[model samples]
Target: MRWALVLALTAAYPLIVYFSLGHVEPRYLALLLLVLGGLRWLAGGAQVVQARWVALAALLLAASTALLNTSVPLKLYPVLVNAVLLIVFGLSLVRGPSAAERIARLQEPDLDARGVAYTRRVTQAWCGFFVLNGGIALVTALWASEEAWALYNGLISYVLIGTLMGGEWLLRRHLRARHARLQA
Candidate 1:
């Protein structure tokens, strides 16, 4: 029930923006919705440490991107929506189930210490990317033209996706090497 609500909220974001402001390009909004919906679906099935971390990272990135592009002024709604999102992200980072927990739930647990470490590394990297992009957006919002916001959004989207793919590849290599060492 809760998951459904979360998914609905995420899916409804673009529509909310569209109805409220009525100015966003439809193609861009559609793209954003498609990416977000895909991420939400992927997250539901992610059981591996790396996959879960990447999914979480993607979710955070999607939420932040939505907030950045929202047409309504931040001040009007008393900023509650943004506040709730930050709280949810922070709690997920702090107390949410780890990949190990998910594995345990599945009863096929192969507790690899390296996998745990890699998950942590990926999570930290994602958090770093989120913070860095968020900071840039803030600076642009304050000091630069609003036009810069779109550029920041595009750059962050491309760079974060690339970083996640690269990180996953490196983690896979590390896992294989560790497995080979154990066999040897």
Candidate 2:
């Protein structure tokens, strides 16, 4: 139930900001975010190091927003999310097993050298995407109007993510078929 509420709030974040802009004070919104951070921290988020860091970041952002009494920090949440993702994906590339390889191994435990290479390339692609996306997100947060910011972060970003995933799936399928033909 707590997870559900958290997820709902997180998903509705853009809309919440968009609607609340005029009527609600930014500090109150920051308080809500602080509540969310508290909930996450209390909900076993600390067990996972990544989640703990995310929760801490959220708490910090909320605190900053409260202190500044500005909506800028609230607007920065998407930028923060993208930065975290970029770090995670970028680190996986530097570390032993890339994140794409890790996820691929879940279904194909006997992943070959070729598969390893492919996943590594995919991870690199994702890192690039994150860098681009994060840059745009930051631009929107800082300079764009609230409506524009919400439009990109809330809607367009999801579409771009879906498009990337779909394109990858299609490419993977084609590569698998080509490999099978070569083997035959």
Candidate 3:
């Protein structure tokens, strides 16, 4: 139930920005971000990463909204989000048990050396993907048309992520089957 609300909020974020910009006061949008941040923190179980990033986002949006009163912050929101994700996934590498491995463990807690290695590599791939995608988002926000930025950030980027996720799932299946065969 909570997850559903978060998903709904996330999906509507760009649209909110699109309609709100110029039509609404920037402070209202910033306040909405702050509210969303609170909801997100609660929905995410208040994980440290989520709390910190969401807070930072709310703060940044508030500052930009109040002082700058421009659409640039809305444009940049996705990039900040990407940066947060990159750090979340990338930093796990240092803390041990990469983010992918941790998630995989929820399904297969008895992961062997090979599974561990595979998940680690997958996490690294995700990190690299975030880096590239975030760069594109940054470029789009900074230099592209508003429509183009909204298209990429609001829609096309999710498609690309879906493609990446689907591709990774397919590869993981093949690799898992190969590993099973080797064991057999």
Candidate 4:
């Protein structure tokens, strides 16, 4: 499936860049960026409004990657992405709708006051995660070995995100069930 292929490419991208450095032609990095961006843009056509930011990020990545020297830029892409995420989440906490609220509304437009508060907390959690992840990514790009960078950014970061997401889902489910029982 398309999602499967996208995930495979995403999971493999850092490893490819890390290992291919000095082993393969630099032009290949540009090619890979184009491919990834094109794929995201195409897939983004059907996405919801809040999620459209991802499409924009993909386009930016492709354009910037094409223009920059691949040597360091390729390694720094994840750092750039995490920084963007940190900003987006941090901004949401200030004045506008929380990122978690936007995402929750996608599924529950009439979510209750409790739900809104809960989503805000979830947003805070995500902001914290982004800060931590972005910090590690910054360190990786600046000082870590290639293998360390690739391993943390490529594998560990994804796992941590999944764990956070899964934990949130489980907690939300438990809260929802408890509320339903109370109402009954």
Going through the candidates in order, what is the number of backbone clashes in each? 0, 0, 0, 0
CA lDDT, candidate 1, residue 43: 57
lDDT of each: 0.48, 0.84, 0.80, 0.75
lDDT of 3: 0.80
Per residue, candidate 1 scores C-alpha lDDT tens digits across 51-100 of 34434454454455455754323211112322333443445457754432
lDDT of 2 by residue, 36-140 (tens): 677666674423666567679889989888898888889888777788778888898898599899989999999999999999999999988888888998898
- On the 0 to 100 scale, the lDDT of residue 83 in model 3 is 86
What TM-score do all the candidates reach, one by one?
A: 0.46, 0.91, 0.90, 0.76
Error of 2 at 148 (Å): 0.3
Relative to the unseen true structure, what is the C-alpha lDDT of residue 17 in candidate 3, on a scale of 0 to 100? 80
Ranking by TM-score: 2, 3, 4, 1
The total number of steric clashes, by the backbone 3 Å criterion, in model 3 comes to 0
Weakest 10 consecutive residues, lDDT, candidate 3? 45-54
Q: Across residues 1-184, which tens digit of lDDT does each residue of candidate 3 receive?
A: 8668766776677777877776887766877677666766777663666656666786777678767777777677778778888888888899988999999999999999988998899899989989998899899888998777878888988899999899999999998799789989
lDDT of 4 by residue, 50-152 (tens): 2356546655665665676455556666776576677777788897578899899999999888988998899899988988988998888778888898999
lDDT of 2 at 182: 100
Candidate 2 minimal-lDDT segment of 10 residues: 43-52
Estimate the TM-score for candidate 1: 0.46
Give Cα distance to truth, residue 113, candidate 4, Å. Answer: 0.6
